[model samples]
Target: MTPETVIGFARSAIEITLLLSLPMLAVSLVVGVVLSVLQAATQIQEMTLTFVPKLVAMFIAIILAFPWLMDKMVGFTRDILLNLPKYIQ
Candidate 1:
Protein backbone atom coordinates (compact mmCIF):
# COMPACT_ATOMS: atom_id res chain seq x y z
CA MET A 1 0.00 0.00 0.00
CA THR A 2 2.89 2.32 0.74
CA PRO A 3 6.01 3.14 -1.25
CA GLU A 4 8.21 1.51 1.33
CA THR A 5 6.11 -1.64 1.22
CA VAL A 6 6.28 -1.69 -2.57
CA ILE A 7 10.03 -1.24 -2.46
CA GLY A 8 10.33 -4.03 0.06
CA PHE A 9 8.29 -6.33 -2.16
CA ALA A 10 10.42 -5.46 -5.17
CA ARG A 11 13.61 -6.11 -3.24
CA SER A 12 12.32 -9.44 -1.99
CA ALA A 13 11.28 -10.47 -5.48
CA ILE A 14 14.71 -9.60 -6.84
CA GLU A 15 16.44 -11.51 -4.07
CA ILE A 16 14.30 -14.57 -4.70
CA THR A 17 14.95 -14.38 -8.43
CA LEU A 18 18.67 -14.16 -7.92
CA LEU A 19 18.62 -16.95 -5.36
CA LEU A 20 16.64 -19.19 -7.66
CA SER A 21 18.96 -18.58 -10.60
CA LEU A 22 22.18 -18.89 -8.63
CA PRO A 23 22.77 -22.59 -9.20
CA MET A 24 22.43 -22.45 -12.93
CA LEU A 25 24.32 -19.20 -13.21
CA ALA A 26 27.16 -20.51 -11.10
CA VAL A 27 27.40 -23.74 -13.06
CA SER A 28 27.35 -21.91 -16.36
CA LEU A 29 30.05 -19.49 -15.24
CA VAL A 30 32.35 -22.20 -13.98
CA VAL A 31 31.80 -24.38 -17.00
CA GLY A 32 32.41 -21.48 -19.33
CA VAL A 33 35.64 -20.50 -17.63
CA VAL A 34 36.94 -24.03 -17.53
CA LEU A 35 36.00 -24.67 -21.13
CA SER A 36 37.63 -21.45 -22.18
CA VAL A 37 40.84 -22.42 -20.41
CA LEU A 38 40.81 -25.89 -21.98
CA GLN A 39 40.17 -24.46 -25.38
CA ALA A 40 43.04 -22.07 -24.95
CA ALA A 41 45.37 -24.82 -23.83
CA THR A 42 44.34 -27.17 -26.64
CA GLN A 43 44.35 -24.34 -29.19
CA ILE A 44 40.88 -25.41 -30.24
CA GLN A 45 39.25 -22.08 -30.90
CA GLU A 46 35.77 -23.32 -31.55
CA MET A 47 33.17 -20.67 -30.80
CA THR A 48 30.48 -23.23 -30.03
CA LEU A 49 32.73 -25.47 -27.99
CA THR A 50 31.31 -24.33 -24.69
CA PHE A 51 27.66 -24.31 -25.62
CA VAL A 52 26.67 -27.94 -25.13
CA PRO A 53 28.63 -28.38 -21.92
CA LYS A 54 27.31 -25.17 -20.46
CA LEU A 55 23.78 -26.08 -21.40
CA VAL A 56 24.10 -29.55 -20.00
CA ALA A 57 25.71 -28.29 -16.82
CA MET A 58 23.02 -25.67 -16.36
CA PHE A 59 20.31 -28.24 -16.92
CA ILE A 60 21.88 -30.63 -14.45
CA ALA A 61 22.23 -27.84 -11.93
CA ILE A 62 18.59 -26.93 -12.33
CA ILE A 63 17.53 -30.55 -11.94
CA LEU A 64 19.70 -31.06 -8.87
CA ALA A 65 18.54 -27.81 -7.30
CA PHE A 66 14.88 -28.15 -8.28
CA PRO A 67 13.58 -29.28 -4.89
CA TRP A 68 15.32 -26.50 -3.00
CA LEU A 69 14.24 -24.00 -5.62
CA MET A 70 10.64 -25.14 -5.39
CA ASP A 71 10.71 -24.98 -1.61
CA LYS A 72 12.03 -21.43 -1.66
CA MET A 73 9.49 -20.39 -4.28
CA VAL A 74 6.64 -21.94 -2.33
CA GLY A 75 7.76 -20.26 0.84
CA PHE A 76 7.97 -16.90 -0.86
CA THR A 77 4.53 -17.38 -2.38
CA ARG A 78 3.10 -18.40 0.98
CA ASP A 79 4.57 -15.35 2.65
CA ILE A 80 3.19 -13.07 -0.02
CA LEU A 81 -0.25 -14.62 0.18
CA LEU A 82 -0.27 -14.53 3.96
CA ASN A 83 0.66 -10.86 3.95
CA LEU A 84 -1.72 -9.90 1.15
CA PRO A 85 -4.35 -8.45 3.52
CA LYS A 86 -1.76 -6.28 5.18
CA TYR A 87 -0.57 -5.13 1.81
CA ILE A 88 -4.11 -4.32 0.78
CA GLN A 89 -4.76 -2.33 3.91
Candidate 2:
Protein backbone atom coordinates (compact mmCIF):
# COMPACT_ATOMS: atom_id res chain seq x y z
CA MET A 1 0.00 0.00 0.00
CA THR A 2 1.44 3.20 -1.18
CA PRO A 3 0.55 6.49 0.50
CA GLU A 4 -2.01 7.29 -2.17
CA THR A 5 -3.65 3.89 -1.81
CA VAL A 6 -3.83 4.34 1.96
CA ILE A 7 -5.28 7.79 1.55
CA GLY A 8 -7.85 6.52 -0.88
CA PHE A 9 -8.91 3.81 1.52
CA ALA A 10 -9.16 6.33 4.36
CA ARG A 11 -11.22 8.71 2.27
CA SER A 12 -13.64 6.01 1.18
CA ALA A 13 -14.05 4.85 4.76
CA ILE A 14 -14.74 8.35 5.98
CA GLU A 15 -17.20 9.04 3.19
CA ILE A 16 -19.12 5.84 3.82
CA THR A 17 -19.18 6.55 7.55
CA LEU A 18 -20.60 10.02 7.03
CA LEU A 19 -23.13 8.79 4.51
CA LEU A 20 -24.30 6.04 6.84
CA SER A 21 -24.69 8.41 9.79
CA LEU A 22 -26.35 11.24 7.87
CA PRO A 23 -29.95 10.07 8.15
CA MET A 24 -29.93 9.62 11.91
CA LEU A 25 -27.94 12.78 12.43
CA ALA A 26 -30.32 14.79 10.27
CA VAL A 27 -33.35 13.39 12.03
CA SER A 28 -31.88 14.14 15.43
CA LEU A 29 -30.94 17.68 14.39
CA VAL A 30 -34.38 18.47 13.00
CA VAL A 31 -36.14 16.97 16.00
CA GLY A 32 -33.93 18.85 18.43
CA VAL A 33 -34.50 22.13 16.66
CA VAL A 34 -38.24 21.67 16.55
CA LEU A 35 -38.32 20.67 20.19
CA SER A 36 -36.23 23.66 21.10
CA VAL A 37 -38.61 25.96 19.30
CA LEU A 38 -41.61 24.41 21.00
CA GLN A 39 -39.96 24.73 24.35
CA ALA A 40 -39.21 28.33 23.67
CA ALA A 41 -42.78 29.02 22.69
CA THR A 42 -44.24 27.31 25.74
CA GLN A 43 -41.51 28.62 28.05
CA ILE A 44 -41.01 25.04 29.22
CA GLN A 45 -37.32 24.86 29.65
CA GLU A 46 -37.02 21.25 30.65
CA MET A 47 -33.56 19.95 29.71
CA THR A 48 -34.84 16.44 29.17
CA LEU A 49 -37.73 17.41 26.96
CA THR A 50 -35.75 17.01 23.78
CA PHE A 51 -34.04 13.71 24.50
CA VAL A 52 -36.92 11.28 24.16
CA PRO A 53 -38.30 12.72 20.95
CA LYS A 54 -34.89 12.98 19.37
CA LEU A 55 -34.09 9.44 20.41
CA VAL A 56 -37.34 8.18 18.93
CA ALA A 57 -36.85 10.13 15.75
CA MET A 58 -33.34 8.85 15.37
CA PHE A 59 -34.51 5.30 15.99
CA ILE A 60 -37.20 5.68 13.35
CA ALA A 61 -34.70 7.19 10.99
CA ILE A 62 -32.35 4.27 11.46
CA ILE A 63 -35.19 1.80 10.99
CA LEU A 64 -36.44 3.50 7.85
CA ALA A 65 -32.98 3.86 6.44
CA PHE A 66 -31.61 0.49 7.47
CA PRO A 67 -31.99 -1.21 4.12
CA TRP A 68 -30.34 1.61 2.24
CA LEU A 69 -27.63 1.84 4.84
CA MET A 70 -26.98 -1.88 4.62
CA ASP A 71 -26.85 -1.71 0.86
CA LYS A 72 -24.27 1.04 0.96
CA MET A 73 -22.21 -0.71 3.60
CA VAL A 74 -22.29 -3.96 1.70
CA GLY A 75 -21.24 -2.26 -1.47
CA PHE A 76 -18.37 -0.52 0.26
CA THR A 77 -17.27 -3.72 1.86
CA ARG A 78 -17.48 -5.56 -1.41
CA ASP A 79 -15.47 -2.94 -3.18
CA ILE A 80 -12.81 -2.94 -0.51
CA LEU A 81 -12.60 -6.69 -0.52
CA LEU A 82 -12.48 -6.86 -4.28
CA ASN A 83 -9.68 -4.34 -4.33
CA LEU A 84 -7.68 -6.00 -1.63
CA PRO A 85 -5.28 -7.67 -4.04
CA LYS A 86 -4.58 -4.43 -5.83
CA TYR A 87 -4.09 -2.68 -2.50
CA ILE A 88 -1.72 -5.40 -1.41
CA GLN A 89 0.51 -4.60 -4.34
Candidate 3:
Protein backbone atom coordinates (compact mmCIF):
# COMPACT_ATOMS: atom_id res chain seq x y z
CA MET A 1 0.00 0.00 0.00
CA THR A 2 1.17 2.94 -1.51
CA PRO A 3 -0.99 6.04 -1.09
CA GLU A 4 -2.28 5.84 -4.67
CA THR A 5 -3.19 2.19 -4.25
CA VAL A 6 -5.05 2.98 -1.01
CA ILE A 7 -6.83 5.86 -2.68
CA GLY A 8 -7.85 3.64 -5.56
CA PHE A 9 -9.28 1.07 -3.18
CA ALA A 10 -11.19 3.77 -1.32
CA ARG A 11 -12.58 5.13 -4.55
CA SER A 12 -13.72 1.70 -5.67
CA ALA A 13 -15.40 1.08 -2.30
CA ILE A 14 -17.21 4.40 -2.46
CA GLU A 15 -18.34 3.76 -6.01
CA ILE A 16 -19.58 0.30 -5.13
CA THR A 17 -21.53 1.71 -2.17
CA LEU A 18 -23.11 4.39 -4.32
CA LEU A 19 -24.00 1.93 -7.05
CA LEU A 20 -25.55 -0.43 -4.53
CA SER A 21 -27.57 2.33 -2.85
CA LEU A 22 -28.68 4.23 -5.94
CA PRO A 23 -31.62 2.02 -6.84
CA MET A 24 -33.36 2.36 -3.49
CA LEU A 25 -32.54 6.02 -3.17
CA ALA A 26 -33.79 6.77 -6.67
CA VAL A 27 -37.00 4.82 -6.16
CA SER A 28 -37.67 6.55 -2.86
CA LEU A 29 -36.93 9.96 -4.30
CA VAL A 30 -39.19 9.53 -7.30
CA VAL A 31 -41.97 7.99 -5.28
CA GLY A 32 -41.77 10.72 -2.65
CA VAL A 33 -41.88 13.46 -5.26
CA VAL A 34 -44.83 11.90 -7.07
CA LEU A 35 -46.72 11.33 -3.87
CA SER A 36 -46.05 14.86 -2.72
CA VAL A 37 -47.42 16.19 -5.98
CA LEU A 38 -50.56 14.07 -5.72
CA GLN A 39 -51.07 15.15 -2.13
CA ALA A 40 -50.74 18.77 -3.13
CA ALA A 41 -53.24 18.43 -5.94
CA THR A 42 -55.75 16.65 -3.73
CA GLN A 43 -55.11 19.13 -0.88
CA ILE A 44 -54.94 16.18 1.48
CA GLN A 45 -52.50 17.54 4.00
CA GLU A 46 -52.93 14.65 6.42
CA MET A 47 -49.15 14.62 7.00
CA THR A 48 -49.03 10.89 7.58
CA LEU A 49 -50.55 10.37 4.15
CA THR A 50 -47.10 10.37 2.61
CA PHE A 51 -45.56 7.46 4.44
CA VAL A 52 -47.49 4.45 3.18
CA PRO A 53 -47.12 4.99 -0.53
CA LYS A 54 -43.41 5.74 -0.32
CA LEU A 55 -42.77 2.75 1.91
CA VAL A 56 -44.77 0.40 -0.29
CA ALA A 57 -43.19 1.68 -3.46
CA MET A 58 -39.69 1.37 -2.01
CA PHE A 59 -40.43 -2.12 -0.72
CA ILE A 60 -41.74 -3.23 -4.06
CA ALA A 61 -38.76 -1.75 -5.82
CA ILE A 62 -36.38 -3.49 -3.48
CA ILE A 63 -38.14 -6.78 -3.97
CA LEU A 64 -38.02 -6.46 -7.71
CA ALA A 65 -34.43 -5.22 -7.72
CA PHE A 66 -33.05 -7.71 -5.23
CA PRO A 67 -31.44 -10.02 -7.74
CA TRP A 68 -29.61 -7.25 -9.50
CA LEU A 69 -28.52 -5.82 -6.19
CA MET A 70 -27.24 -9.19 -5.11
CA ASP A 71 -25.31 -9.63 -8.31
CA LYS A 72 -23.66 -6.25 -7.88
CA MET A 73 -22.74 -7.03 -4.32
CA VAL A 74 -21.36 -10.42 -5.25
CA GLY A 75 -19.29 -8.92 -8.02
CA PHE A 76 -17.89 -6.28 -5.71
CA THR A 77 -17.09 -8.86 -3.09
CA ARG A 78 -15.41 -11.09 -5.63
CA ASP A 79 -13.32 -8.18 -6.83
CA ILE A 80 -12.22 -7.30 -3.33
CA LEU A 81 -11.41 -10.87 -2.50
CA LEU A 82 -9.47 -11.39 -5.68
CA ASN A 83 -7.51 -8.22 -5.03
CA LEU A 84 -6.71 -9.05 -1.41
CA PRO A 85 -3.09 -9.78 -2.12
CA LYS A 86 -2.61 -6.32 -3.54
CA TYR A 87 -3.91 -4.75 -0.37
CA ILE A 88 -1.92 -7.05 1.86
CA GLN A 89 1.27 -5.14 1.14
Candidate 4:
Protein backbone atom coordinates (compact mmCIF):
# COMPACT_ATOMS: atom_id res chain seq x y z
CA MET A 1 0.00 0.00 0.00
CA THR A 2 1.02 3.59 -0.52
CA PRO A 3 2.22 5.69 2.41
CA GLU A 4 -0.91 7.80 2.36
CA THR A 5 -3.14 4.76 2.50
CA VAL A 6 -1.12 3.34 5.37
CA ILE A 7 -1.35 6.62 7.24
CA GLY A 8 -5.06 6.79 6.60
CA PHE A 9 -5.53 3.25 7.91
CA ALA A 10 -3.58 4.09 11.03
CA ARG A 11 -5.55 7.27 11.54
CA SER A 12 -8.82 5.44 11.16
CA ALA A 13 -7.66 2.77 13.57
CA ILE A 14 -6.92 5.42 16.17
CA GLU A 15 -10.24 7.14 15.56
CA ILE A 16 -12.11 3.85 15.90
CA THR A 17 -10.26 3.10 19.10
CA LEU A 18 -11.14 6.51 20.50
CA LEU A 19 -14.75 6.16 19.47
CA LEU A 20 -15.03 2.73 21.04
CA SER A 21 -13.47 3.81 24.33
CA LEU A 22 -15.12 7.21 24.64
CA PRO A 23 -18.22 6.21 26.61
CA MET A 24 -16.38 4.13 29.17
CA LEU A 25 -13.74 6.79 29.62
CA ALA A 26 -16.30 9.53 29.91
CA VAL A 27 -18.27 7.57 32.49
CA SER A 28 -15.15 6.93 34.52
CA LEU A 29 -14.09 10.55 34.32
CA VAL A 30 -17.47 11.86 35.43
CA VAL A 31 -17.65 9.31 38.20
CA GLY A 32 -14.20 10.22 39.41
CA VAL A 33 -14.94 13.93 39.45
CA VAL A 34 -18.25 13.50 41.21
CA LEU A 35 -16.78 11.15 43.77
CA SER A 36 -13.90 13.49 44.35
CA VAL A 37 -16.29 16.33 44.99
CA LEU A 38 -18.39 14.18 47.31
CA GLN A 39 -15.34 13.05 49.18
CA ALA A 40 -14.21 16.60 49.60
CA ALA A 41 -17.62 17.67 50.86
CA THR A 42 -17.95 14.72 53.23
CA GLN A 43 -14.24 14.67 54.09
CA ILE A 44 -13.94 10.92 53.43
CA GLN A 45 -10.55 10.48 51.75
CA GLU A 46 -10.42 6.84 50.87
CA MET A 47 -8.75 5.69 47.63
CA THR A 48 -11.12 2.77 46.97
CA LEU A 49 -14.01 5.14 47.44
CA THR A 50 -13.02 6.64 44.10
CA PHE A 51 -12.03 3.37 42.44
CA VAL A 52 -15.11 1.23 43.07
CA PRO A 53 -17.66 3.69 41.78
CA LYS A 54 -15.54 4.50 38.75
CA LEU A 55 -15.19 0.83 37.97
CA VAL A 56 -18.90 0.17 38.31
CA ALA A 57 -19.80 3.21 36.25
CA MET A 58 -17.34 2.28 33.59
CA PHE A 59 -18.67 -1.27 33.52
CA ILE A 60 -22.23 -0.05 33.20
CA ALA A 61 -21.21 2.36 30.49
CA ILE A 62 -19.51 -0.41 28.58
CA ILE A 63 -22.52 -2.68 28.95
CA LEU A 64 -24.86 0.02 27.72
CA ALA A 65 -22.59 0.93 24.85
CA PHE A 66 -21.56 -2.58 23.89
CA PRO A 67 -23.97 -3.00 21.00
CA TRP A 68 -23.02 0.30 19.42
CA LEU A 69 -19.39 -0.52 19.93
CA MET A 70 -19.82 -3.88 18.23
CA ASP A 71 -21.59 -2.25 15.30
CA LYS A 72 -18.80 0.25 14.86
CA MET A 73 -16.13 -2.44 15.01
CA VAL A 74 -18.01 -4.62 12.56
CA GLY A 75 -18.47 -1.66 10.21
CA PHE A 76 -14.82 -0.85 10.40
CA THR A 77 -13.86 -4.43 9.72
CA ARG A 78 -16.18 -4.51 6.73
CA ASP A 79 -14.69 -1.30 5.40
CA ILE A 80 -11.21 -2.71 5.70
CA LEU A 81 -12.26 -5.89 3.95
CA LEU A 82 -14.02 -4.05 1.14
CA ASN A 83 -10.95 -1.92 0.61
CA LEU A 84 -8.54 -4.83 0.71
CA PRO A 85 -8.29 -5.11 -3.07
CA LYS A 86 -7.35 -1.49 -3.40
CA TYR A 87 -4.66 -1.85 -0.76
CA ILE A 88 -3.31 -4.94 -2.45
CA GLN A 89 -2.92 -3.07 -5.74
Candidate 5:
Protein backbone atom coordinates (compact mmCIF):
# COMPACT_ATOMS: atom_id res chain seq x y z
CA MET A 1 0.00 0.00 0.00
CA THR A 2 1.04 3.60 -0.59
CA PRO A 3 1.97 5.95 2.25
CA GLU A 4 -1.27 7.85 1.71
CA THR A 5 -3.32 4.67 2.02
CA VAL A 6 -1.48 3.77 5.22
CA ILE A 7 -2.09 7.21 6.66
CA GLY A 8 -5.75 7.09 5.67
CA PHE A 9 -6.19 3.75 7.38
CA ALA A 10 -4.46 5.02 10.49
CA ARG A 11 -6.62 8.12 10.56
CA SER A 12 -9.78 6.07 10.09
CA ALA A 13 -8.75 3.72 12.88
CA ILE A 14 -8.24 6.64 15.25
CA GLU A 15 -11.53 8.19 14.28
CA ILE A 16 -13.38 4.95 14.81
CA THR A 17 -11.74 4.52 18.20
CA LEU A 18 -12.71 8.02 19.30
CA LEU A 19 -16.28 7.57 18.05
CA LEU A 20 -16.66 4.31 19.90
CA SER A 21 -15.27 5.69 23.15
CA LEU A 22 -17.11 9.01 23.22
CA PRO A 23 -20.45 7.82 24.53
CA MET A 24 -19.10 5.95 27.54
CA LEU A 25 -16.59 8.68 28.24
CA ALA A 26 -19.22 11.37 28.05
CA VAL A 27 -21.53 9.48 30.36
CA SER A 28 -18.74 8.95 32.87
CA LEU A 29 -17.76 12.61 32.73
CA VAL A 30 -21.29 13.78 33.36
CA VAL A 31 -21.75 11.34 36.18
CA GLY A 32 -18.49 12.39 37.77
CA VAL A 33 -19.37 16.05 37.60
CA VAL A 34 -22.77 15.51 39.07
CA LEU A 35 -21.34 13.38 41.82
CA SER A 36 -18.78 16.02 42.54
CA VAL A 37 -21.43 18.64 42.85
CA LEU A 38 -23.50 16.47 45.11
CA GLN A 39 -20.54 15.79 47.33
CA ALA A 40 -19.79 19.46 47.52
CA ALA A 41 -23.35 20.28 48.50
CA THR A 42 -23.89 17.51 50.98
CA GLN A 43 -20.34 17.37 52.42
CA ILE A 44 -20.46 13.59 51.91
CA GLN A 45 -16.95 12.97 50.70
CA GLU A 46 -16.89 9.20 50.77
CA MET A 47 -14.76 7.52 48.16
CA THR A 48 -17.28 4.79 47.55
CA LEU A 49 -19.95 7.39 47.11
CA THR A 50 -18.12 8.63 44.05
CA PHE A 51 -16.78 5.30 42.82
CA VAL A 52 -19.94 3.25 43.02
CA PRO A 53 -22.23 5.66 41.24
CA LYS A 54 -19.77 6.32 38.42
CA LEU A 55 -19.25 2.60 37.96
CA VAL A 56 -22.95 1.91 37.91
CA ALA A 57 -23.63 4.76 35.51
CA MET A 58 -20.90 3.63 33.20
CA PHE A 59 -22.16 0.06 33.35
CA ILE A 60 -25.69 1.13 32.55
CA ALA A 61 -24.47 3.28 29.69
CA ILE A 62 -22.47 0.41 28.23
CA ILE A 63 -25.41 -1.93 28.52
CA LEU A 64 -27.72 0.55 26.81
CA ALA A 65 -25.19 1.41 24.10
CA PHE A 66 -23.94 -2.11 23.54
CA PRO A 67 -25.91 -2.72 20.38
CA TRP A 68 -24.80 0.47 18.66
CA LEU A 69 -21.23 -0.02 19.76
CA MET A 70 -21.24 -3.61 18.52
CA ASP A 71 -22.71 -2.55 15.21
CA LYS A 72 -20.02 0.04 14.61
CA MET A 73 -17.24 -2.36 15.55
CA VAL A 74 -18.67 -5.14 13.38
CA GLY A 75 -19.11 -2.83 10.43
CA PHE A 76 -15.55 -1.56 10.72
CA THR A 77 -14.19 -5.07 11.02
CA ARG A 78 -16.27 -6.28 8.07
CA ASP A 79 -15.10 -3.39 5.92
CA ILE A 80 -11.47 -4.09 6.73
CA LEU A 81 -11.87 -7.83 6.16
CA LEU A 82 -13.79 -7.46 2.93
CA ASN A 83 -11.29 -4.97 1.57
CA LEU A 84 -8.24 -6.94 2.68
CA PRO A 85 -7.34 -7.89 -0.86
CA LYS A 86 -7.45 -4.29 -2.03
CA TYR A 87 -5.12 -3.26 0.78
CA ILE A 88 -2.85 -6.20 0.13
CA GLN A 89 -2.45 -5.10 -3.47
Candidate 6:
Protein backbone atom coordinates (compact mmCIF):
# COMPACT_ATOMS: atom_id res chain seq x y z
CA MET A 1 0.00 0.00 0.00
CA THR A 2 0.95 3.59 -0.50
CA PRO A 3 2.01 5.86 2.35
CA GLU A 4 -1.29 7.71 2.17
CA THR A 5 -3.21 4.43 2.37
CA VAL A 6 -1.10 3.31 5.33
CA ILE A 7 -1.67 6.59 7.12
CA GLY A 8 -5.36 6.47 6.44
CA PHE A 9 -5.58 2.94 7.85
CA ALA A 10 -3.63 3.96 10.93
CA ARG A 11 -5.89 6.95 11.50
CA SER A 12 -8.98 4.81 11.07
CA ALA A 13 -7.66 2.23 13.54
CA ILE A 14 -6.97 4.90 16.13
CA GLU A 15 -10.37 6.48 15.61
CA ILE A 16 -12.12 3.16 15.98
CA THR A 17 -10.16 2.40 19.17
CA LEU A 18 -11.08 5.72 20.70
CA LEU A 19 -14.70 5.41 19.72
CA LEU A 20 -14.95 1.97 21.27
CA SER A 21 -13.24 3.02 24.51
CA LEU A 22 -14.76 6.46 24.99
CA PRO A 23 -18.04 5.36 26.51
CA MET A 24 -16.50 3.26 29.26
CA LEU A 25 -13.85 5.87 29.91
CA ALA A 26 -16.42 8.64 30.13
CA VAL A 27 -18.56 6.63 32.50
CA SER A 28 -15.60 5.86 34.71
CA LEU A 29 -14.56 9.51 34.75
CA VAL A 30 -17.98 10.70 35.76
CA VAL A 31 -18.28 8.03 38.42
CA GLY A 32 -14.87 8.90 39.80
CA VAL A 33 -15.67 12.60 39.99
CA VAL A 34 -18.98 11.98 41.70
CA LEU A 35 -17.40 9.58 44.16
CA SER A 36 -14.69 12.08 44.91
CA VAL A 37 -17.23 14.77 45.60
CA LEU A 38 -19.21 12.45 47.85
CA GLN A 39 -16.15 11.39 49.73
CA ALA A 40 -15.18 15.00 50.27
CA ALA A 41 -18.63 15.94 51.47
CA THR A 42 -18.97 12.96 53.78
CA GLN A 43 -15.34 12.94 54.91
CA ILE A 44 -15.10 9.22 54.26
CA GLN A 45 -11.69 9.33 52.57
CA GLU A 46 -11.53 5.56 52.32
CA MET A 47 -9.09 4.33 49.68
CA THR A 48 -11.20 1.38 48.54
CA LEU A 49 -14.48 3.23 48.69
CA THR A 50 -14.34 4.32 45.07
CA PHE A 51 -13.15 1.00 43.68
CA VAL A 52 -16.32 -1.04 44.03
CA PRO A 53 -18.63 1.63 42.72
CA LYS A 54 -16.38 2.43 39.78
CA LEU A 55 -16.03 -1.25 38.97
CA VAL A 56 -19.75 -1.77 39.14
CA ALA A 57 -20.50 1.29 37.07
CA MET A 58 -17.97 0.31 34.43
CA PHE A 59 -19.33 -3.23 34.31
CA ILE A 60 -22.84 -1.95 33.92
CA ALA A 61 -21.79 0.43 31.21
CA ILE A 62 -20.01 -2.35 29.34
CA ILE A 63 -23.03 -4.59 29.60
CA LEU A 64 -25.33 -1.85 28.36
CA ALA A 65 -23.03 -0.86 25.51
CA PHE A 66 -21.93 -4.34 24.46
CA PRO A 67 -24.20 -4.62 21.45
CA TRP A 68 -23.18 -1.31 19.99
CA LEU A 69 -19.53 -2.02 20.68
CA MET A 70 -19.75 -5.41 19.04
CA ASP A 71 -21.47 -3.94 16.02
CA LYS A 72 -18.77 -1.36 15.56
CA MET A 73 -15.98 -3.88 15.93
CA VAL A 74 -17.65 -6.34 13.56
CA GLY A 75 -18.22 -3.66 10.98
CA PHE A 76 -14.64 -2.57 11.18
CA THR A 77 -13.42 -6.12 10.82
CA ARG A 78 -15.70 -6.74 7.87
CA ASP A 79 -14.55 -3.61 6.13
CA ILE A 80 -10.92 -4.56 6.59
CA LEU A 81 -11.52 -8.05 5.35
CA LEU A 82 -13.45 -6.86 2.32
CA ASN A 83 -10.74 -4.36 1.47
CA LEU A 84 -7.91 -6.83 1.79
CA PRO A 85 -7.52 -7.14 -1.98
CA LYS A 86 -7.10 -3.40 -2.36
CA TYR A 87 -4.38 -3.35 0.28
CA ILE A 88 -2.64 -6.28 -1.38
CA GLN A 89 -2.60 -4.50 -4.71
What CA RMSD would you report for each candidate? 0.6, 0.6, 1.1, 0.6, 0.8, 0.6
Whole-model Cα lDDT of every candidate shown, in order: 0.96, 0.93, 0.88, 0.94, 0.94, 0.96
lDDT at 41, model 3: 97
Q: What lDDT score goes with residue 15 in model 2?
A: 92
lDDT of 5 by residue, 1-89 (tens): 98988999999999999999998899989999999999999998899998988899999999999999999999999999998999999
Alpha-carbon runs more than 4 Å astray in model 2: none
Predicted structure 1: lDDT: 0.96
Q: After superposition, how far is residue 66 of candidate 6 from its true place, in Å?
A: 0.3
- RMSD after Cα superposition, model 6: 0.6
Could you give candidate 4's per-residue lDDT for residues 1-89 as a string of tens digits? 89999999999999999999899989988999999999999999999999988888988998899999999999999999999999999
Candidate rank order under lDDT: 6, 1, 4, 5, 2, 3
Off by over 4 Å in 3: none
Q: Would you estimate the TM-scores of all the predictions?
A: 0.97, 0.97, 0.90, 0.97, 0.95, 0.97
* Colliding residue pairs in candidate 2: none
Which residue runs does candidate 1 get wrong by more than 4 Å? none
Q: How far does residue 74 in candidate 4 sit from its true spot (Å)?
A: 0.2
Question: What tens digits encode model 3's per-residue C-alpha lDDT throughout 10-71?
Answer: 99989989988888889989988988899889988876778887788888988988999999
Error of 1 at 8 (Å): 0.4
lDDT of 1 by residue, 1-89 (tens): 99999999999999999999899999999999999999989999887798989989999998999999999999999999999999999
